[model samples]
Target: MADAGYVLPDEELAQLQKLSSDFEPETTGPLVGERQSSAAITTEYANADPVYRVKTAALPSKYAYFRTCRGDGHCGWRAIAFTYLEALVREANVGKFEEEEARLMSINNLFNNVGINYELIIDFAEEMFDLLHKLAHSVSSNDGNADAILLQAFNDMGTSLSIITYIKFLASAWVQAHPADFEAFITTGDVKTYCSLSIEPSQCELDYVAVGALSAALIKPAGFAFEIMYLDRSAGEEVNATVFSQPTDQNGMLLPNPPTIRLLYRPGHYDILYKAEDFPPPVQQQPIQVALANPYNDSFIPSESSVDIMAMIPGMYSTSFGHRWPSVPYEFDASPTPQAQVTPVQPYTPTPASAAPVNTSRQDYMPVHASHQPNHSNTGRHGLHLEGPPVTLPIHSLPPPPVSIERGHLTLERGGPFRPSMYELEQINVPSFQTSIFKNSQYNTAHYMNPDFQPEAWSPDTEYGAGHKGKHKPPAQ
Candidate 1:
């Protein structure tokens, strides 16, 4: 019997019992439910070969399109060839291969067997995608010669761009996935050997990958700042008006911008752009002179406080010197020292007005010494006498007058004969080699008399003489 409140139908009750049974595992063993089932589904999907799928989708499109399109024979053939090549590469890069045992395996086996990195396989996939996109969008409808040339150029550019993009992506992914291996390889500094297998020959191909990998390894982001110095040529001074940040793309290409600082003279305007990290520490303010002949082509010369205007330009001109901020050190020690000490002296004071009135007239003073007359006028009187030699004026001494002589003749003192000194002749010495040869007489006589008697005498047999010959003799000899 069923309760009155429950009102359960027979079919509905059976369905609920089934649902409960499914939710609860068999009590006899262990419970296996949705988690395990979901994992199995994910594994199956992941294990399915991606390369096979790419090729299956790519090849049919490659062949079917060319068969249907009716175009210029030459152009059509070219497009067909490019399509076939793209398909072949995509096929090689994609899908799983079946074995004789009918076992399924991951497509990675294809790349792995060839010693290709798995990430490079992905990059190749991406590269094919780009090439296919370009091929689909190509507009080669015009049959003119110009159109043909343009089409060829575009095709070449496309190929180059695609190849470079593929290499960059491949290197980047390999480095990222196998960081430890990449680090060990990079430490050798011969990455070219390791990378040569996968890397393209063009520098552009490797640029992005190398930059990205190095940026990650070094952990330094590239940045640039421009210090804009405005020059007032008339005033002969420069003012740092602003510092501008240069904009760069994620891939590190600089953006174009107008000149930050304007100057009266075009050549005077200078912009020095350098990496922020590479810039040296700021030192004393260095005055720079800029030549203004050609605005684009100018020269920079540094000076202390002012630059020579004449050096900048050949013509003479006055220069104005201006500085935004002086780089001089301003702080100093204020402690007192012995040499800098200050002394205080007492002020002179006059006598009080009430004490005395001093005479002001010149006649009030008396002389300290007076002439005295002797009391005894007789010649026999004893008197104090001073005895000393008579004082005489010194005679003025004058230098002798200059004497001019003829060019060939030598001047003498007043009038005297010129004579050569024996000391001067004795100071001269003859060379030892010359003295030795002269003593022997044989060598000196032949040297002086015969025009061909040479100091550097040489013949094939005795070319360098005994001294040089012995020094450079062959080991066997």
Candidate 2:
């Protein structure tokens, strides 16, 4: 066996020898020399167990190959472990590892522990296609309108739940980020975080939430009609005109009507209309005139013909003069009576010798007659002469009497005691010759007896007229 063709090559035998020398047996089992010889023999034995035997055929060699080089020339332990895990996966039906599931799971876990980061949240949203797919599949499988409704409800519920969950998560995140604010909230016991968060909710938010459950129960799909009644407590008894209109689309056709909404008010409510068409016409009226009546008696008559009877009809009436004429006229006689003629009495005149000097300065003079002369022989001392009776004489034949001068004393004589003469009697001038002698005498007496008396001064030339001889007998001296 050593020299024949079955013998190994030198390099090969050397390699075998090296392998055998390096092999060491346990002390309790065998000696090193025997183990080496046995290992060398085992390299040739092909029928031995490869894992257990060190000699007999190539079992040891096969075992060394199996340990160092796995089934496909790789390590056997790692291969075996991988194969076991693979078998388990197949049995459990855990599909292939998905990157999307891992990503979704990571986001879900983040929100569950802390809060939703809106930035990250958008990634977990399903596509419209996916949503429609699920919805269609569910509808087809369930095959009922109720199922359709339920499906929509479920979707709505899901959206609501997601929103609510997100809100809760956000609250948690805020608390974590602001611990002081959280402590304040806890102390105050007032959870106004949503209101205080500065997120302004619109009218839709309030109304929708208020009517959410009711709306959900009543709302139906297409072809279903809804009626709702609303009582207006604010409306008064009299209501104005109410109006209803259908909101239109761009093409002018009415859009789908919203649910019917009713407004109830008091029956007698009157509404004032502002539009001209609703107004009524106004009414017209006519005017009337009144007349006054007369109250006087018909038998009573007025004095004047031009008087208005209508005016007197209302005045007082006189019954005593009713039958008598209102006015009367009287008659007068026009006759002349003859007068008797008598001889005129002459006026008395004084001779120049007896007469006092005529005051030429006196403007007023009385006319004298020849019957007024006193005899020249009847003279007193100092050329004084007695006054004869007043002579009835014609006014034109005698010289006008001297104008009587008003003075304190009368200068009757030049040297003798002054004697008052009734020269005023000769000075009297009468317009009528028929004047009574007694009346003339009375006037002459009044002048001589008057307390304030002054006799008229006579000039010597006037006393002795130009017809007489020069200064004869000084008037019976």
- Considering every candidate listed, which one attains the maximal TM-score? 2
- In order, the Cα lDDT scores of the candidates are 0.24, 0.24
Off by over 4 Å in 2: 1-133, 136-142, 145-159, 163-252, 256-477
RMSD of each: 43.9, 77.6
lDDT of 1 by residue, 1-477 (tens): 678456667658889988875563222211101001011111111122332211211111111111111111122222222323332222222221112001112333433543556565464445545543343333222222332332343246444344334434444444644556456546444444445533433332222234334223211211222232232222311222334334355777765541121111112111121111121233111211011111112111112222232123322121111111111111111222211322122110112321111101111111100111000011100111112111231111111111110100111111111123221232243332222211111111011111111111111124222221321121120
Model 1 score (lDDT): 0.24
lDDT of 2 by residue, 230-292 (tens): 212232211222323233456756557432211111121111111111112221101100000
Q: Estimate each model's TM-score.
A: 0.15, 0.15
Instruction: Provide the lDDT at 367 for model 2.
Output: 29
Per-residue lDDT of 136 in model 1: 32
How far residue 206's Cα lies from its native spot in candidate 2, in Å, is: 2.5
